[model samples]
Target: MVRKIFRVLLTILGVVTGFFVADSIINSNYIMNLGYFNNMVAKVSLYVFATLSFGIILFLLSPIFYKGVSKLTDAVEKSIGRLSASEIIFGAIGGIIALLIAALFILPINKLLPPKLEILGTVLSIIINTVAVVVGVDISVKRKDDIMALFEGWKKGSSKDKKGKVKGVAKVLDTSVIIDGRIFDICQTGFIEGPLVIPSFVLDELRHISDSSDGLKRNRGRRGLDILNKIQKELTIEVQIWEGDFPQIAEVDSKLLKLAQKLNGKVITNDYNLNKVAEFQGVSVLNINELSNAIKPVVLPGEDMNLTVVKDGKESGQGVAYLDDGTMIVVEGGRKFIGENINVTVTSVLQTAAGRMIFAKQKEV
Candidate 1:
């Protein structure tokens, strides 16, 4: 019904446009005599013919155009449906700011240029303005901290709590870090300082995942969301969900890197791949796994430690146990005593790109 209405409206519009074109052709001589038009009516009449022909072609193709547009709209809506209204509003504000900045630089050139070049300048200004606005919005959304920082200086003198001590480093908690669930305990300790940031997109992704049909993924997603709520509600530290996104960059990791780079902040994540990618891109990453490994009590080779043989390892007669933090300890010749706890001497420690591994053998202690 709406399409039919649009078609009728477009047809009426076309007919009205055609009448104007026909009148212009009939009154070309009179129009040519008008000042500031430079007797360009004959050329302008040709342009009118071109425009009318183009409009007619567009009218004929309207149905096809509508179908294509509808499909694109559906795709966009599905992919970004999780976005909240506030995020959309924030993006719009950023875009407008960008457009205004672009126009500020563009309008001067448009006004200063010669009359003949003015038309070209106007077209260029529009293009530049659009690019600036979109780019500005993208940066503002991605570097949400930078956008906030613009106004943050106004509150500098308001904080009179600590004057001379060094400030703590801010840790931007990515979604994976929160989902991993170790960060909560890490923050409970006094080691990591400053505020924690949770980007709005990360929250949206978590929410979408939590609503997924797969049981395991759904659980993990919900766990992450729950962890986020706990940090926000229970923890004493400042937890903020930053409204930031880079629409041009589809991948969340890319947005994270861009945000980290912009804010001079370190990304805290447990994702192994993201850690490597961020480092390659020159973005600083503080891997939660790495921190756990580092802070775990140092157990050197030949050191005798008490461990439990809970399960069999891949190698024959090897028993596997875990530390409180879930670090794996492999004990050779202890597989038979699966239910018993025994002392084992560390044979070697294997460190990988992801984390640390320890190998040990039954020790007489």
Candidate 2:
């Protein structure tokens, strides 16, 4: 019923538009000079022909146009529905400011213009307001912090009392660190005091991975889910499933960082690349790999440690041994002692975000 009404309105508008268009063409000096437009009968006939032609064309095409408009309307409505109250408030404030600024700019021009030039001022006012909207967006982006602060001041009397800390509120967990399973242990120890946020997008990725035909990915995904269950049921820290997602962001890691920024929280991850990206973006992150490295026992130079070389290192005649914590020890000239328990004196230690590497040689007999 609404669609039929819309089609009827469009056809009527088209008829009105066609009448004015034909009248203009006939009244114009250049067009009137044309042979066909010279006669009154031909001019009257053209008006009727154009009006009926335009109305028919519009009536035929209304369904397609209506579908497009309906789709666009739905998209906008959905987007607006997802916006928070603060965002809607900010948008309203910005629009009003833009209108006031445009009015101020045009008021002088409108006053200086002659009565006949009033339309000129009206056109300029429209153009200026269009520019003002763009200018408003740019200014808001540049002074976004100031605008947020102003709104916050209005909502809350004074911020002096509130430290404005979101640290304890949100703790975003990424896929890599969740699958690592150490985060559950850390949480069980009662170190993490706040709610752990697991985004819906990350959960979707895990579900996909868990359903993968690839055995390794499937296992890893299942393990991640199992760890999350443990963290929820076994640990005391609150686990929150964040339903919000950023469709504009493609990568899971990128979305994780964006979520952390929005929540004003820290990301917990073991992915080396993600760690670096989060640092570059100025988002706080707690790296599981780094934590593990920090807690590993420090092996001073000349300190004797017993190790059984399990494999050969990158260098020839260098035996590789791993600490229980997964720190690698490169034992020089100990290739012959492979699979044999031997004492080694640490020569040096190379510490990195990836892990720690200890360079040592077998101890003297």
Candidate 3:
């Protein structure tokens, strides 16, 4: 029924177009001089024939038009679906502003053109409007972060009267830190402040890892996702999943640095390589490994400590033990007591970017 109605409407539009065409041709200076279209009957006959012919043609082509319209609607819907609400709002505002600016120039410009160049004026006006709208949307998209930040700052100002006000910094999370799972514990301790910003690309990488063929990678990936869920549910701080991404950047770490710079946020990760890269790029990084090292119990030389000799170290008589926090202790001349718990005196402590290592000699039996 809808198709039939649409076909009828199309036929009517075609008939109206045909009538206008016939009238224009018949009234033309050349046609008037020929004197054949002067008679009322002849003109009426011609108009009726043109209208009927166009109506029939359009009715026949209605199915093709329906298919074209359907495809167009689907394409538009898909494009709109990919745009975020903010993008759409900005785009609409941009388009309106462009049109208004175009209108301001179009009237005077059109009047200044020669009558023969009237079509040129119309074309130029259309081009100007198109260019303006494209430029506006591009600018809006590129400056979206700045615009959002301005709005957010204003909002925060309005709510300054509220008690227990905490200023939140944007803390962007990296894939490695999520997989390390220490972030969850750190958040639970209430030491870290700010809105935990998880990039969409990081989440995508995690998903890929979780679906990997290698069992170890798959487990790590899944654990990261689980940790993210725990943080979102248990932590009092805001956990935001940021949808913004930089397509120009190929590597996740590079993209993360770009995102941090854009948000004016710090990158949180346990990745040594990423930490160094961020430092070189002048981006702030909150390294989980560094944090862990800082909080580990301080060991001084001549301090007595007890540890189980779990394995032999690289040295011929060095037995390896670990502190509760996983700090390695190298016990001298204790290789014979690999399976036994022994008291050791801390001889020295070495700290590196990786972690802290304690060098000690076994206490006398």
Say which candidate scores most in lDDT: 3
Which ranking of candidates, highest lDDT first?
3, 2, 1
Candidate number with greatest TM-score: 3
Please state the error at residue 31 of candidate 2 in Å.
38
Off by over 4 Å in 1: 1-147, 158-170
Ranking by TM-score: 3, 1, 2
| Candidate 1 local lDDT, residue 78 | 79
Listed per candidate, the RMSD to the true structure in angstroms reads: 7.8, 7.8, 3.9
Candidate 1, residue 9: the lDDT equals 64
Position 161, candidate 3: lDDT: 34
| Model 3 poorest ten-residue lDDT run | 159-168
Alpha-carbon shift of residue 285 in model 1 (angstroms): 0.8
lDDT of 3 by residue, 1-365 (tens): 87888899999988998898889889999999999898999999889988998888998998999889989999999977766677788778877877888888988999899999989998999899999888888777678778877998899888773556486778999999999999988888889886899988999999999999999999999999999999988888778887766766889999999999988899999889999999999999999989888989989999998889999999898899998889999999989989998899999999998798999998766
Worst 10 residues of 2 by lDDT: 158-167
> Which is superior by lDDT, 1 or 2?
2
Candidate 2 lDDT, 132-202, residue by residue in tens: 87677556544554566477667666445354433365799998888889998898786776669998888
Tens-place lDDT digits, model 1, residues 1-365: 86776666665566567667765655588765663345568556655775677568657876876788789989989755655565566678889888878877887888899999978997998789878877876676555555566666556546654544334556778888888998888778856775787887788889988999999989999999989878777777766666656678898888888877766788999899999999799888889877877877777999988888899999999899998877899998989989898988899999876677899999873
